[model samples]
Every structure is written in structure tokens, then in C-alpha cells.
Target: MGTSYWRGELWLGPDYGLVQGQLGHTTAHAHYAHQLIIAVGSPVTVELDGVRHSGHCLLIPALQRHAMVQAPDPAFSLYAEPLRIAASDLQRCVEGVEASLPKLQAALEQCPRQPIADPRVERALQALDATLEGKVAATQLAAEAHVSLSQLERLFSRDVGLSVRRLVLWRRLRLAMALVLQGQSMTQAAHGAGFADSAHCSRTLKALFGVSAGQALKTLNPRLLA
Candidate 1:
């Protein structure tokens, strides 16, 4: 295994994001969005549901347990929300040997601008986005969406590809990661992101990205791009 130093730049959009820079191995984890990882300098190996896959570019479906078993010095990871961009569209943009970061960014820019048709689901998602600190509950989101708890849950699964709880946690994790990258202490980041404590945040970090908060803070000096 190589050093765990992963310096990178993160560009965030409304429904998509891109991370480009040095990357290392990741522990087994899963995400709520479709991910396309393009290796730099050399081929990379990924462990998907315990199966090993090696390629210069790999696409992991939403919610599939996987890990980067091996990666080169630099890599480009693109995360696209399932609702905003179809998997085939994303794949086609990065296909063959000419794939690059600019191409992926262009792909994101080309995504359909149309909003979700379901007003309730959109309202619920807006509520979650408004509360990135994890301060809101499902019941509150349901209320915001003007739906029952069961209906909200059903709508989330149908439209968001995740449960309300998972979406909340994912949003918090993103906030916590950004805080950590910005030089906050684990405890501070944890609290700032609405985690109960540093321990809970650490556990969630490892579970989600297969890295500890300390390691991420120390190693992943991600520059947030405008």
C-alpha cells in the first residue's frame, strides 16, 4: 500500500460534484449516488461487493458496497445524483481513453435542468438541504412536504433512491467532511455537523468513506473550489 496522503480539489454543484487529485485506498463503503472514478497515471483496483475489479475507469452503481483497493497518485471521482443524471449518460461522457476532468465537468453542466416533477419530494429535499447540520428530523421533513411519515418515506425511496434517514446522514457527512478539510478539529467538525460526539462522527466517517476523521483532516487537504 502507498502513503495515505490524498491532496485534492473538490468542486461542488447542486446535484453533482467532482474530486480531483492524489487518492489512496478506501475501506469498504457505499454511497447514495452513482460514482465514476477515473484513475490517473495507472490503473486502479476496486473491490465491489467482495469482487475485485481493475480498470482505468470504473463506475459504481448507487448504494453498492465497494472500496478502492488500489489507486495511483492522482484520481478523479465524479458523483452524480441519480435523479439529475442517468448512469448511461455519465458513462458515455467518460468512455474510452480520452476521458478527463474537464469532460466530466462538461457532463455535469449538460445535465437536464428540469426540476423533479413531484412537489412533495422536492420540498422534502429542500428541507434537508436547508438543514445541513442534521438538526431536522424526518417528521419535520414530512411536515414540510405536507405528507405523512409513511408517505414521505415512500416518496424518498421512490424519487431519491435513499431513505430519509440515509439522506440526512449523507448531508451531514458532506458538511462534516468539508469542515474537516477546512482545518476544524474532529470534535468541532462533529458538533458543527450535528453529530452527537466525536466518536459518532468518527464511526460514521469510517463507515461512509472508509477513513477516520483524524486521517482525513491530516491527509486529505481538499481545497474547495468555487
Candidate 2:
């Protein structure tokens, strides 16, 4: 069967800004700041100040230095207003946020923790980590894990908190943004990232990032490219 399509969305408050978008093999550099990150995809390993987390999402506050290495596939993220809530208070705030963010929250609610012994999720993650531009199928992923599609879905949902389809779309968007950042032409980036065409890429980018690809490209740096 064909790969399923999953929709990933992020809502950022006024204080937050998008820092960088680069290919999976590319490394991004940004000053660490306090913020919350909502992962709208499968489990990803994120490194912050030399510490790492493999989970569905995280709520990191200010002064907590961080960086990320998204899975080989595309990943989705959102930056929220920083708050000073203790773990208990943070949980309450998450509850409130989830109530308001039904779709994202639902995806989070379904995520499962990674297993320590079985490394299938780890292997699948490696495959996605290897490339920033490409297509991946759930069936193939399941086959690699030596499980059926249904079993893969259950394991993913149980351990990562989201579905495979959502993870793929998120990864695609991430790659598209990366290509645009690297000075790739919109058409090139669109097709390279697996969109139907430039128009399709523009529509999806605007819908997700709240700006047209052209606008996003222009903002990539202070000096505009010709």
C-alpha cells in the first residue's frame, strides 16, 4: 500500500521566532533560549546543552540551552511563550494547552515511550535521520522492523505518541524549509521535497508556517537573494 498523509500544524506565540531550516545532514546553529517545543511527529532525539531526549514533545523554559537533530524524515515544531512553571504546574499548563490544542494534544496523548530492549524504533529513526529529502512508506518501515503494518502502527502510537503518516508530513515540511534556507529555488525545493509542484509547496508552507515560501525565503537572511 501507499504511504499515508498526515497533517502537522504548529502555533507560535508572538515572542518566538523561527531560527533555522537545514537538511537532515546539515547542521543548524542558533543561540539557545528558553521556549517550549511541541513535536508533531514520531519520537525524535533532541539534544539540548549536551543532554538528549527521545520523546514525543517537550516544554523547555528559558535559559535552558538546547539544539535538535530531527529524525531523518521531516519533523514539525512550535515555540510557545516561556513560562516559569514547576513540574507540577507545568503539567497543569500542559493540560490547559492540550485542551486548547485538541489536534496536537490528541497526537501527544497517544504517544508511547520507547522500549529499552527492542531497537526497531531506533533503526527506523536512523533511516529517517539519514536523509532530509526523500519519501518513506509505513509498510516499508514496518517490514524493516519485522512487524506487520498494524503492529507497527500500534508500536509507534504506543511509544512515540503519533502516527507514521503525521511524522512523514512533518519531515517533508522540515526539508522544504531547509532547502529554501539553503538558497534553493522554490521550484527546486518544492520538487526536491516531494511536493506536487511549487504551488503545492507554497500552499502547504503558508498553511503551516504562516508565510508563503517566497516570504520565508526572503526572511531567511537580512540581505535578500536575487
Candidate 3:
């Protein structure tokens, strides 16, 4: 057995993403995006709020603390922004063990799109996305959204289900992962993603996804599609 476990395809995007392959174990963590895990070949185990869940299909809401206790070989994990993807939409994609990648993707394609109700929040998100490679301040984002700092925070909470800081961190992780896919070292990726150091990046990665930067790169080898 090796540390490298994941295989197959990985598609990284700003609002939605997918990674499929020999799944890797993950520690308890919560993220800003909704997660859907559909197992292939065998069932996967997920632990949420101290309770363990095992099945071929599992859906987790944004910011809900959970962990992948056991991710068996061949699994498709989807991440969608809660602002755009409704929980009910993801529920329809849960088709158990018989679910194939094509079927799951088709379901995802058919999922209804929800426009962000708040223009301020939309502006803030776009501003944040554009500045992930550099330093960003809360006040700066508030200015971009044309709202006060406190009001911006409220807008993010009501529309995105998490703090703007946490969302920025999550997007930074995605950028770091993309840099890794482009052949950059973890240290380089960390700096490129505006982290203080590689150790900082690694800690954040492990905290969120239960995998180290080096481990993720190895696991995703030759299969990552950015």
C-alpha cells in the first residue's frame, strides 16, 4: 500500500468541482461548499456530528462538520457552492451504489441554477476570486461590494452560509491545488496562493480535506485536470 490513493479524473472550478478515483481517508472537517459523495465498487463511511454513516451515496451541507472515515476505491465526490446549488438539487443525485459517473454528472447538469439574490454578495465574491493570488482585506471587499464591513459580513452569512474569510481560505486551497497540478512544489504553490508558507498551506489543507499538500499531489498524480 502507498500514500498515493486517488485516481481517475479531477475537475476544479470556482463554484463547482468533481474528483473521482480511489478515494482517500479524511479527518473530521467542514468546508464552505456542499459535498456529495457517491461510492463506486463499495460503500464509503462518513462521520458527522459524532455519528457514523456508511452508504454508497452521502450528501453533506455546507459548513456541516464531517469526515471521510473510509473512502473505498472508486468514488465520485462533488463540491458545489451553496449559493448556486440547492440542497434539494443535490438530494436528487443520490442514487446509491448503482450510480455511475455519467449518471451523476447528468444529474448535476440538470440541477437548477439559482442566481445569487444579493448583488452586493455577488460583487464581493467576484472581488475575492480575482484577488486570491494576492492579499485581500475585509474592508477592501466591503468597498468592492459597496457596503459597510458589518453589512458585508451579514450578506455573506445570509447568502453563502459561511464567513468571507473562510471562503477566501477555501478558494486559496483550490488555487494551491491548481498550482500543484501545474508542476509547482508545495512551497511554491503556497506562496502563489498568498499563504505565509508551505507549512501554513499544508495545515490548512489537512484541516479542510484531511490530506497534506504532498499527499494530495501524489494521490492526484497524472489524473488531475485542474
> How much lDDT does each candidate structure score?
0.77, 0.49, 0.77
The TM-scores, one per candidate, come to 0.84, 0.46, 0.86
Of 1 and 3, the candidate ranking higher by TM-score: 3
Q: Residues 1-226, candidate 2, lDDT per residue (tens digit)?
A: 1112222233322223322222121122222223344444455565656677767556555335444555434444433222212323333444434423444344333333224345776566556545435667787788777778898788767655457775565556656656665668878987788777889777765554434554445533421111
Given candidate 3, what's the lDDT at residue 45?
85
lDDT of 3 by residue, 1-226 (tens): 2224465677665456777787777668887778988776678888997899999778898888897777656888888878788876777655442455555666676677899888899899889988988997989999999999999999888887778798888888878877877778888999999898999889998888766665556656433432
Runs in model 3 with CA error above 4 Å?
Answer: 1-8, 93-103, 222-226
lDDT of 1 by residue, 1-226 (tens): 5645556666666567787776667778987778888876788788999999988778998889998777865888888777777777777755653546567777668765446879999898888878867577889999999999999999988888888988788878777766766778878888888888889888887887777765555654455434
lDDT of 3 at 184: 88
Candidate 1 Cα outliers beyond 4 Å, as residue runs: 95-103, 181-185
Task: Provide the clash count, candidate 1.
Answer: 0
lDDT of 1 at 59: 93
